[model samples]
Target: MNSTVTMIVRLLLAIILLVFGANKFFNFIPMEAPPEGSFMDALIKTGYMMPLIAVSEIIPGFLLLINKWKGLALVWLAPISINIVLFHIAFDISTIAPAALVFTLNTFLIYINWKKFRTLF
Candidate 1:
């Protein structure tokens, strides 16, 4: 892929992730109570812990958007993607589509920037 396209993709990914992450912190998206006995319900049952999860989402999202911490942002992306994918898989497969797309795009972004992450080896 062209470098310009790669950069654009990265920027878009960063924007989307950052906005969504901020939503978790800001509750720009209203929270609905999970259904009784649902996996989400179980998660909510953990109480204050829920906000911590939201923080995890928000922080990485912010990092990605800044673009200065691309490597750290990518590191954070893995767990966030896994959580989103699993949440959809276990709770609501229908909603998984967007998460899947994000995951796919993030994977591509990571691959395109793999050189920056090479120091981890």
Candidate 2:
């Protein structure tokens, strides 16, 4: 991707992360809950899980916005993104679009920053 496009994608994803993360605490944006007895229901049942997810989103979102340790930020978000996608895929087919977008963005970022990760492997 061109630098401008990459920056746009990064910003878009970062803003989404920050907004959703903060929303978890502030409820600024209404979030839909999964139906009862689903996999995500189990996660939501753990009160701390939401806070923890908020931190995860906020930290990596900030990292991406500041253009610092971006590869690490993507790494941090990978599992969270994966889980988000899987949760939607398994429990809520109706609202899988956003989760799919998030996962796609996360993957694109990881691929774009692969050079920084070469040393890890």
Residue range with the least summed lDDT across 10 consecutive positions in model 2? 31-40
> In candidate 2, what are the lDDT values of residues 1-121, reduced to their tens digit?
7999899999989998999899988998876776898766777798899889999999999999999989889999999999998877786779888888889999998888888888878
Candidate 2 lDDT score at position 59? 97
The TM-score between candidate 1 and the true structure equals 0.80
Pairs that collide in candidate 2 are none
Model 1, poorest ten-residue lDDT window? Answer: 18-27
Best by lDDT: 2
TM-score for each of the candidates? 0.80, 0.89
In candidate 1, which residue pairs clash?
A: none
Best by TM-score: 2
lDDT of each: 0.76, 0.89
Residue-wise C-alpha lDDT for candidate 1, range 20-105, written one tens digit per residue: 76775576878676789977787768786567776776666677666678778778887788778888888789779878877887
